[model samples]
Target: MTKDFTPPVRLDIDHLQSLYRSGGLTPRQLLDRLDDYQAAFTDRNLWIHYLTPDEREPFLQTLEGESPDSLPLYGVPFAIKDNIHLRGIPTTVANRHVRIVPDASAFVVEQLLAAGAIPVGKTNLDQFATGLNGTRSDFGPCGNAFDPDWISGGSSAGSAVAVALGMVSFALGTDTAGSGRVPAALNHIVGLKPTLGRLSVEGVVPACQTLDCVSIFARTAAQADRVLTLADRRNPTDAWQEHQQPPKRLMGQSFRFGVPAADQLGLVEYPEAQALFDATVAHLEALGGTAVDIDLTPFSEAAALLYDGPWVSERQLAINDLVNTPDQVHPVVRDVLSAGDQFTAGDAFSARYRLAALKRRTDAVLATLDTILTPTCPAPYTIADMMADPVALNARLGAFTNFMNLLDYSAVSVPAGFLDNGMPWGVTLFGPAWSDSTLNGLAGRLHHRVTDTVGATSDPLPDEQPPQPLRTLQVAVCGAHLAGYPLNHQLTDRGAVLVKRTRTAPRYRFYALAGGPPYRPGLIRTEDRGAAIEVEVWRMPEDRFGSFVAGIPHPLGIGQLELEDGTWCTGFICEPCGMDGATDISDTGGWRRYMASMATTETRQ
Candidate 1:
């Protein structure tokens, strides 16, 4: 049977629809394919609760009883994270003692069933979705589908693995931080964490009730977007769910993407990962995303709040009973949950206060640009490496994720490429809350444009070369005009496409102006005192650049800024007078890069 079953890996939703429509494969055939998937994954630890053939046969038979018009998913098989309820399938959450109800499908699960998608099983996850590495699951860490020795990222481990292994057309997972995203990065799949509260959270166990989100895993961002559309129906039971439409295109030009400085601790040791990330960032600009540098401090601080502060208690609050009962909980999960006991209500309140402040700071920074792109995982670790240092490894994995939920943002992790050693590197696109639709559309385009393959499938998608409108001026901004920074909106609101990041010639000086809610940096041209400043260039519609130029204040005027290698374009510059009282932040180079350095120093202090 294993020899005969060659189920197409990464069977997208449309392909399934075509097969079911042509009578080439029935609901029963898909079920048999799922069985084959189960057999193929002999040691991958991909599933936590698989529906028995008896349980799934009836659903398949019922589909046979109906015509194509009745089924949206038709015979497409999918998997769900055990944290979500599934009728007749135990929602173990990778734990042994959790009570399992026999017939409570999560609202989304019911919606999928109504659309004719068959549930094949429940996948594994970090215990209560606490860790980022898949290793924390009681069912055994979900090993990477692409490479057995590597860690399949988690807390959404099994769902990613299931899809990567051709076990299902798509799967459901939860993202709190990078659970939904990191695993997809490791397994080379698409992970979509919808806008907070966009998808109904009713019937699913909470990791952090205030910030927990139901995420989707699929072969393509397009498929994930479709699933989100189907599951986005109004639910009176979930107050967080809201009706919204997917954005057709992002407005503005010169999208400024925030990238971590090379010196950032997370990337300092992982040079190869850093190189891969740098290349990805360059790719974004090459694809027309303006790259900017920002301080990583506030983000790192927010991440620390998740585990070091009181948010762990929130998870305890969700599954308090199972956590408090000793024998019922997995030992590892017990240790993680027990840490929450140290927190008091005051701690929770304090953490909330600090997080709010940090979020404001984050938002102020993000307001300057359209999107923030970062490595889905700073570095990849193998199961053995993770087992040797579980806590540290886990913490490192969440470096880019823990702040997401805390800040009320949405993110999608898409495959970028493999490291030199063959492990994968993925990039994540993050936007503020309610921007899921926008980010979804952006990620869909990015995936099709930059990535050659979808999910774990070997099939390559044709390159979608983006349109470059002629008669536009590409202006680079090293400071405020960079998106998500305080001044970036000025460019975006005027229409800009972030084109690239190129260093200015060694004749430029960087200054931090004194007494500036949004800090402003002054770039001055000096013969002996200047060094190349790291700045991002954004292309404004030539029609809009003139108006943008008109808004510039004195001292900080627009000029042709020369790059390190003699490339020159219009950008923000300061007169000698502006530097009188300004701090010579030239040593740090550009504004965002300087901010990144400051953030790191502050965290250590």
Candidate 2:
């Protein structure tokens, strides 16, 4: 058990695609890696449920009849968190008393099935998805994928292990309070938590409906992104699913990323983790991104609301049956659920009001950066450590994650590096909702820039990306220039693709600059009186973005643009002093949208 457990077998999405196309490995050959994984871990509680190869034979047989192009995830295996339902498999949530479901796959699982991914089995989790540590389960805790003695973080514990051990290509876990993310940090993988409601919640047991997101666990950022974009499908039967507009891509050669102050609790712990994170910041700077220290008071306040405020009521509501009938649940889960009874509806509204105030404060602080970068987890933990004091350990695990869902932000946690103990440490790139794709692209680039290692596989890193015949650049445009709006053809004529339609980082103000052919927005950057103005990032060849920027008139110029995430790119930014006698339109956060809203309001009046 003491022997190091890095799986010799590894699988990555892009590489697997290349392999499938080139015939380096067949679907069946890859599935055999499961046997290797089982042997490597040897009953590591990584699975609360497992599908026998014989049981998966029919799926494998069907794959052989289809062409490689017919199946993107053809023969690729994945694991599911026990909280998510899978047909013919039990959804236990690691609680022995729960009855196995007779039918239906979670919407996310159904989509993966359609993509031709085979499910290995349901993995373990904290009972009812209540804790960050895997140890809370009735089933034994899933050990860290790298070191058996340490904890494999939860509630996505076994899902992370399944991927880390190469048991599957990727795994699905639910992130309520960092369950999806912390495990990835503890067990070297990418954990993608899409904006809330982007992924459907149907067929999954709820932890906290308003805050829960089905997350992906993969070896590389690209794989995680692929799964995320592919899995973000709507289920007609599911009413809770929220369709998001496409993510706005941010364009720039260099970016300015934001980091928590050096004195921050999470940032200061584990000198080595801090060093690794700081080194990553330095790497980004060297690669043309700037990092700035910011006060984390607002973010911390939002995080406190998750456990300290009435939000605990949401968790209580999620398992009302178990709470009312405590005998039906695991002891630890029962205790966790019991706390929810402490709140009333009045407390919920009061918390909401406080959260709104915090959001306003956060928006003000967010106005200064492109994206925010933080350690995925404050520090690592082990099974024994959690058993000693589960609640406190769980709280520490969510030090970074609890606030994200509550604030309605999108984030991606990529493998930054290994800790001094040889366990993994990860960092997350976070931005406001719908900025998922921007963070994904940035994360993909950063993953390649740093580790260059794909998944848990043994394949060598590919050589540098050769220059594209026409390298793309992301450009931010507001006002009559926005897509589908008047004068929008300026970009289409130059072969630009609209990647997303979202707001700027919460840092810029929109102004009705005195005059133009069609009124234009003059984006002025300021210490206050500004919000992240809405804009779209169009991917054009470097030459095209350049030509477009050059044609932009004075007062309306493209400088550096920050997305909701803390990463900066070249976009639209006015001279800080541009507000002279100009009508302040900062409250709107976007020029075109603001003008349209103003026109609508005028009509209504």
Candidate 3:
């Protein structure tokens, strides 16, 4: 079978779709190829339960008479973490003693299955999703895809490895404290931990019920984004589910991003990892981002509260019966959850109070930046090393990730580079809640820039990209609405950000309209004689745009105006009748220059 089978080089959503269209591969062929590939990794501890051919047959048969173009994820294969429900499949969560066969799939899983995705199997994880290092599992440690000796970084260990090894196009993993991201860094894949509640956790075993998030593991950020779009559905039945509003696209051609202060960097002991992080910062700068040093004190303090404070009790509450019978749990995970016994109800309230204060501080810092960039994990550790110092080392892996859920942020971890020893490494870009798409877009661009391949595969990165977000619109302002002018606040107060200062196409006439103290300029497209007029382009959330346009007075209205670069955007334009009493100011070049001339005239008088 191995000699006759040749696996597809890439399993990205687009690649799979193209193959299905061209008749190069079918869902059954890919599944058979994956089954053949899995034979070589029997000892890797990547799966807790490998689905039998009978178990996968129904999903394959569902798409038999359907066209590939009918469903968004038609024929895509995905792995489900052992903790999440998959209909009749057993959810062990890496602990055989508490295994339960759920009658229905998770809310997210059902959404994927309905869209024609095949559930390959349930992958291994840290028992009860309690640890950061992958070794704290009853099924044995899941090692890195590149080297079986190293830790895969978990509790999402097997999910990351499956995607990294290209056994599936994507996988579902749950993240409460770095489980999703740490594994991605170690295995070289894209791990997207969307905002809490963005993906419903209706059928998943919870680590900390309030903090648990169903995350996606894929070969590229684009694939992760595609999976997220399909999996994220409004689950009115789940109390914890939230309807996320349309996200604003904050990351653009130029953005400000926060980085941990030099003294607070956790990679001080890992020189190679530190060097890679520095290079990543430089690469972001080259991509039009300004690095701003931010104090990591509040974020670090909040991270400590997750395990050290009463939040651990939430994990205990999630599995009440198992907590009472600690012997059933892995020894390391048992020790960790046992800490919850010491906290009282008072401790929970006090911890919540402290978290609220720290949240304020973090929010203030983020308000000035588009996103925060951090190393996904401090460094890679071997499975032997992880098992030896389980507690301390697992805490180290959560250094940059634990605070995200507590603070309600969206994050995407993408492969950054590899270390000297050939271990993979990655960095995360995170921002306020509902910023999932923006972070994914930025991560995708950065991933392509730093690496040519995805996971451990030799397949080249796909040229086709994820659809760009359209939640914001760009508008150009030539007069009163220009930055520092009287009407500029109208734009700024509506959450608009200045994109750039440029000139319009040399096919417009600029006129100073007859108006009061806060005068306006009128731009008219002229074919015969015209000159470029200076303007400032600003982008604002689409939801706020209607209000911004509604407040415009008389002849000045929003219309498409061509810029010097030939790009058209909504901008201020004038009706021909409004030019009756207006003075031509074309010779002054722009509104700013004309205003300067007026100021000089007033001083001389």
Q: What are the TM-scores, per candidate, against the unseen true structure?
A: 0.74, 0.76, 0.87
lDDT: worst 10-residue window of model 1:
1-10
- Residue 226, candidate 2: Cα error in Å is 0.9
Query: Which one is best on lDDT?
Result: 3
Cα lDDT tens digits, model 1, 311-429, are 77787787775555666665666677678999988888888899889999998888877788888878788899988888887888888888888887878888777777766778899
Q: What tens digits encode model 2's per-residue C-alpha lDDT throughout 42-160?
A: 54688787777886776678777775588778767888999998887777778877756748788888888888787888888888898887887777888887776788888899999
Of candidates 3 and 2, the better by lDDT: 3
Worst 10 residues of 2 by lDDT: 462-471
Regarding TM-score, does 1 or 2 come out ahead?
2
TM-score of 3: 0.87
Q: Give residue 426's error in model 1 in angstroms.
A: 0.9
Question: Which candidate ranks first by TM-score, i.e. highest?
Answer: 3
What's model 2's lDDT at 492?
72
lDDT score, candidate 3: 0.87
